[model samples]
Target: MQIRKKIYWSLCVLLLAACRQSPPPSRPNPVLQLREMGQLATTEYELSKVVRARDEATWYKIGERRMLVSCRARIKAGIDLSQIRDIDIQAQGDKISIKLPAPQILTFSIPPENIRVVYSDVGLFRTPFSQAETNAIMQQAEKQIRRQADSLNMLQKAQEGAAVFVRNFFEQAGYKEVTITYRYQENAS
Candidate 1:
């Protein structure tokens, strides 16, 4: 009877060990995941700018030439995740802290189809504005759109959106508390 009891106990132990579950697979590092995201564009805006240029009739010039051009630009702003370093992310238990680069305009484009010649005036003595001249004016308009990005609060909105996204991402990754901060950048608009 003792031998039978010993055999049963051994079999029970062996079964328990064999049925034990294996450890789950390790997950990718959160910091590496963020870095792989490249740039996270959070906000997009379609903006329009009108530019007018007048070449006054000077002593050397025959007559005045004035042109008005309008252009629509698409701007995308976000944090550059590629700039995220390993040290920028810290995880302890269920809490995580991350430092991100300041948001900036990621893309600014003026599609040719979106440009319009709103108005054009050419003096009788002055030749009509050349295609090259029109292109130069459009370039100037693009620059103006870039400069206005700050005033339009695009960076601010992008920063807010990035913070929300990071927070939600960490939370979904099982982090209970997520703290996000930004590193200041010069000319980050």
Candidate 2:
């Protein structure tokens, strides 16, 4: 009877331990995930322009030099996810709201393969356009593209793309409704 009582108590203890509930799994914060995404490239713009440079005739040089280059510039625009602050995200049950930073140009490049000397003219006494001169003209074109980014609507399209991405991401993360908005900016790239 003594052995029986000991065995019965041990069985009761084992059953209670097995039936105890474990803590529910914690959900990861979505805002942290977004910040970890860093720069999100949402749109790319390919622009082609013809740039011209001219050297007027000097009394000593006796002639003029002119060159025209056709170059293609690529611009990437997106929102910087790492800029998201804690206050930028709000979660309430199945709904989530996010305030993203204004979109900007993340990268600009003029690939060498996309540049060509479309035209050149040099007087008999003038020196031809050198590689250095051509490079300078290409740089000028790049700056012009940067200045015209706003007119091309690059940032606006980037913002729209980012909104779509956020909505899809949250919906897949079990959020029933997602609202995305951007902060105001004095100037955008």
Candidate 3:
């Protein structure tokens, strides 16, 4: 009877081991493809120049009609430049286009017609610096830039985490084709 009990216990242990699930098989990471819709051109225009009224009794209209002018200029100028023309995302034979809304002027303190100008001089240092020091500084900056780029990549993965998981699961299940489309919502004013 003891030997029979020992054999029964051994059989139970074997059955338990056999019923246990094996660890899931690992696979190579998926590569993401990013495509740019078009180059975003930045255009700046000087809306107006205005003069400030120091005294409260001044007869000048508080907010008067202003002249509006627009001309093509380099993006480096300090002007009111705000616009995003085109953006698109594509993945696994599916494409999604993102449309950015127009920017609105939230607040303005300067009068429309008065001429108020402010300028600052930007000077470059004439003294020569060592190449080694410059290279070191650039290396540090490059490291920081790479870290930011990695963070952005991680954020993109997180944003598409569910889709990625689904795709991976389907692939593991022997499905060949899977696609996802993402759309942007326009803001209501």
Candidate 4:
């Protein structure tokens, strides 16, 4: 009985030890990959433009509906740092040359809270504007803002800022001479 008790206790201890294993390694968070790679987006243009869009439709030449919405869209244009590869950053002695991605619009926002309705018109014969109609106006307003993006010089500004950013970044890495150039792409704006 004493040998049997000792054998059962040993088996129980062994079973408990077998059930315990080392914890698995933690995975790296994908959201922090860019930061881990030392790449940072440098937005140089935060342009706010007020746009006006008019939607009109005529039915049977006797009924017509027209809508004009004036709103402001905030545009942020910059280069995506995540596109940078290790090969793009070439450092030879004190000089560093980096080929950066083309500048693009990072974010376009027209917050409902920020959009002020300057004027809303409904013709006498036309019905009041529905939710769909209002949403359409906002979308049109966004398009107008995009069309005027070049006129606002956002692309140039973003590229210039990105160059400065990369130069500064390399400078911190002990590079004295920094040359930053953009990799041109077709239809890039």
Best by TM-score: 2
Order candidates by lDDT, high to low. 2, 1, 4, 3
**What C-alpha lDDT, on a 0 to 100 scale, does residue 11 get in candidate 4?**
100
**Tens digits of lDDT, candidate 1, 92-127:** 999899989988888888999999898988888888
lDDT, candidate 3, 1-189, per-residue tens = 999999999999999888967899999898668743332222222232222212123355342222222111111111111333334323343323333333222222222233222322222422232445334443444344444433333323332443454456556766566553333323342
For 51-121, candidate 4 gives per-residue lDDT tens digits of 45444644444444455555556667778888888977888899988888888877777777766566666
Clashing pairs for model 4 are none
How many backbone collisions does model 1 have? 0
Q: CA lDDT, every prediction?
A: 0.87, 0.87, 0.36, 0.72
Each candidate's number of clashing pairs is 0, 0, 7, 0
Please report, as a residue range, the 10-residue window in candidate 3 with the lowest summed lDDT: 71-80
TM-score of 2: 0.72
CA displacement after TM-score superposition, residue 160 of candidate 3 (Å): 27
State the lDDT of candidate 2 residue by residue for 1-189, as single tens digits. 999999999999999889967899999776653433589999988998888888884667778888889988888999999999998899999999998999888989889999999899998987888899888878888888778866988889999999999899999999999999887742242
Query: How close to the true structure is residue 112 of candidate 2, measured as C-alpha lDDT?
Result: 98
TM-score of 4: 0.61
Off by over 4 Å in 1: 1-37, 185-189
Ranking by TM-score: 2, 1, 4, 3
Name the lDDT of candidate 3: 0.36
